[model samples]
Structure formats: C-alpha cells, structure tokens
Target: MDKKHLQTPSQTIGPFFAYGLTPTQYDYEFKSWVDNNMVADIDAPETIEISGTVFDGEGQAIDDAMVELWQDDGEHKLYGRFGTGTEENNRFIFKTIKPKSVNGQAPFINVILFMRGQLLHTYTRIYFADESSLNASDKVLNSVDAKRRNTLIAEKVGQKYSIDIHMQGQKETVFFDL
Candidate 1:
C-alpha cells in the first residue's frame, strides 16, 4: 500500500490584501510598502491623477477591493497600490506621471485587481484616450474587439483621467490572462 498526497485548496484573493498591503487605509499602525502616490515629485509636468471605482457583478461599488498600478515608460518605472475602503464611494486613486510610448507601443499603465471573490488577481491595461494615434497602432490594443477597446481606455476629465472597472455584467472590463 502507498500513501497519496493531496493538494491544498486554493483560497479566494481578498480583504486580506487590503489589511496587509494597505495597512494605513485599514487604520493599521504601520504604513504600506507601496502607496497611491507613484511620483517622487508631485509637481512633475506629467503628473496626473487616475481615479475610479470598482464595481461588482451587480453594478454595486465594492468597498474592499485593492488595486495596483504598474508603469514603465523606458525612463520611469513606478508602482502604486490603493484600497477602495479608504475612499468615499469606494473609489481607488493613483497619482502618477503619464507614461511615454516605449518601443512604439502605446503609453499605458498596467493594472492588477484583487477582490474578495477572485481566486487570483486579474490584470488589465489602461490606455490613455488622448493617445489616439498610438492607441490605433498598438498591437495589444488592436487585438481587442473595437467595441470593447473603450473598456480599457481611460478618459481624460479636466486635468486627470477616470475609468471605472466593472467586475462583471455588460460593461465588464477586459482582463488579460498572464
């Protein structure tokens, strides 16, 4: 007779990330390693604010989600993390500089979402709506259906950008598999 080993069950990604990764947001004693501010100099010419809400399948705002942003413009590489529970109306905001096109690719910010029901975090990209030319030529952007492309582009509102992420439903965001 031989003994067999069993694999442990996978747990859903969640509220734990909000407590550990976004300590300050949850009123923890210590600060998080990464914060919503990605720029070292707040007054940088390209500095901009990205704000949005994370909605659930029912189209209700999720107050406990954690969002992470990553950008590399061949010059500046920055990362920012935010928890929706800290903000009013469950919005996540990131203060970062606009990324520049690298190797002919359209300038975009990579986003990762971790929510209570997800077994693993989802990945997406935020393309600037103003970068029409570059966006039209971007391989990754073009790969998505023309109608669904809007789901990935962040709209310019006043001096900042805004984009809502819908976890499900008709307006669901385009998440990529890695």
Candidate 2:
C-alpha cells in the first residue's frame, strides 16, 4: 500500500494570523504587503480618509480585528488593509479617494472584516451618507430594508468618512453573504 499525506482540516479564523498578515501592526521586522493607504499618490485632490472601529456583541472594541477596503471607479482600483491593533483606539483607518459612481450605482467601498472568532470573514459596504440622491437610486442599497440602510452608510465626520461596524447587537452592521 502506498502512504499518502493528507491535508489538515481548516481551522477557525484567527488572532494568530495577525503576525503574518499585518507584520507592521504587530511590531514585526517586515512590513505587510498592504498597509491601509490605498492611494498611490497622497497628494491627489480626491484623497480622503475612512475610519471606523469594530465592536463585538457587547459593544466592546475589537482590538485585533483586520479590515480591508476595495473600491474601483472605472479609472482607479484601490485596496487597503488595516489591523485594528495598530490604531490607538482600536480603529481601522484607510486613506483612499472617493470612488465615483459605477454604472449609475451609488459610489461605495466594499469592506471585508476579519476577526478572531469569525469562522469566515464578513462582507459589507460603506455608502456615503451625503450621496442621498445617488444612494436612493442604487438598486443594491435599496435592496436592504429601508430601516436598516443606515447601518451601511458612512457619515461625513469633519473632513473624513466614518462608519462603525457592529458584529452583533441592536445596531449590528448589515453584512452580506456575498
């Protein structure tokens, strides 16, 4: 009989992977492939900052969570990743340009959240609260119940956009399976 090595079963999501995935955040010698800045040119006129914190069921901040943002506005495709532990208040901050509406859809950024307890990452969107007219016409935004739509909108706080993500509880952010 021939002996074959079998692959190990998949494990739950991590607080372990942070050292490798976000080396800089964990004070490692090497830098991570992606660090929160999505803009290639920081001086770009459209550059903006998006910041937020992830909260658990009990509303405590998730200090070890990782957040990724993806946005494509026909011309530029931007991506950013940030570990909450790197921020003073356990928040994730991304520097990127405000995406333009794509194919008439509301301008939004796709968010993927990774945390220790989650078996799989959660997906969500950050819609601009100021884009009321555009958001109202967006089919995807409208698909979510009107009452719960606010969970996905990022409010303009001073010069930056802010949106808090609730893993569970009354104000839980709306996560999509996709």
Candidate 3:
C-alpha cells in the first residue's frame, strides 16, 4: 500500500496567518455590531449553526483554529460585493444565507485557514449544491472528475453547514495559496 503522509495541527511549525492580531475592515462593523447590538442573533430560530472540527491530514483536531468565510447573500453578484475583502478579515459564521448563482455562474465562497504556528495561508473555494449544474458546467470544476469535485462542497446539515479541511497529508486537497 502507498504511504499516506499527513500533517497534524501541532506539527505545523511555520508562520500561521495571524487573525485578530490587528483590526481588520470588518472589525469596525463587527465591533459596532456588537456594541450597538447589531450583531446577528445567532441563537434565533432562524439562524443556522455552522460549526465543525478543523483537522490536519492526520485527522487531528485543531483547537482554537479560526475559519474565515466569504460568500454572497443571495443578492446581486454571484459573489457578494459586501465582504471585507483581502485587506480586511472575513471571518464569519457559516449561518449566512445560501447564495444564488448569477449568469449561469456558480457562486464561489472564499475561505482562509488559520492557526497558531503554521504560517501557511491556504485559500479554499466552495460552491453550493444548487449550483451543482453550474459546477457541471464550470471550466475549472468540470475539468476534474465528479468525485474530486464533490470534495469542494460543504455538506448542509439542517441549518448548519460543515466542511473539514486537511492541511497536509496524502490525498490532501490543494487550497488556494492566498
């Protein structure tokens, strides 16, 4: 059998993306949201609870690791124009609304993987199932086999969505090198 190499969270020894270390663009809004009681009521019945485990290639849990996500709000752009952008952190809960594709384009959500020591900043893109038809039509996603394409999607569990990331190991999925 072929050896499957994997990296544990603790094994990450390089520079990890530092979050909350500095105030980001959304920080102001988030702060104001919290201060003015504008933050979304996550506990509301309408709110979705998106939570999951961050594992390494070895399937080890990475505690305290932050997952940042950005997607459209079922609004105008296939990708929403409301996100904080690259300069600002886009750390958000998974409970956001399911976005719609535009012009036959499946909306892609941007993700950033962050931890304590590993400086490796990986950017991952995810698409919605509603846009699976678009996935079948996307130049990039269609280039790959269906099995591999399915891996890029996050499973929706009731109101919660979950996507587990394996940083390094055999069969590791390549994340965007942001």
Per lDDT, the best of the predicted structures is: 1
User: In candidate 1, which residue pairs get closer than 3 Å at backbone N, Cα or C atoms, i.e. clash?
Assistant: none
lDDT of each: 0.89, 0.87, 0.50
Error of 3 at 107 (Å): 2.5
lDDT of 3 by residue, 1-178 (tens): 6798786544442232233332232354222212111124433334334344556666766654555666554552222212212221222344455555666766666766656555665677776555566777877566556656665776776666665566666535546544
Off by over 4 Å in 3: 1-49, 73-93, 143-147
Better of 1 and 3 by lDDT: 1
Q: Which stretches of candidate 1 lie over 4 Å from their true place?
A: 1-10, 41-43
Model 1 residue 113 distance off true place after TM-score fit, in angstroms: 0.6
What does candidate 2's lDDT look like per residue over 1-178, in tens digits?
Answer: 6789796754455887777888886788877888888986456687788998999999899998889898888888888888898787898888888899888999999998888898778899999999999999999988998888999999997679999999998898899978
Residue range with the least summed lDDT across 10 consecutive positions in model 3: 30-39
Q: Positional deviation of 149 in candidate 1, in angstroms?
A: 0.4
Q: After superposition, how far is residue 16 of candidate 2 from its true place, in Å?
A: 2.2
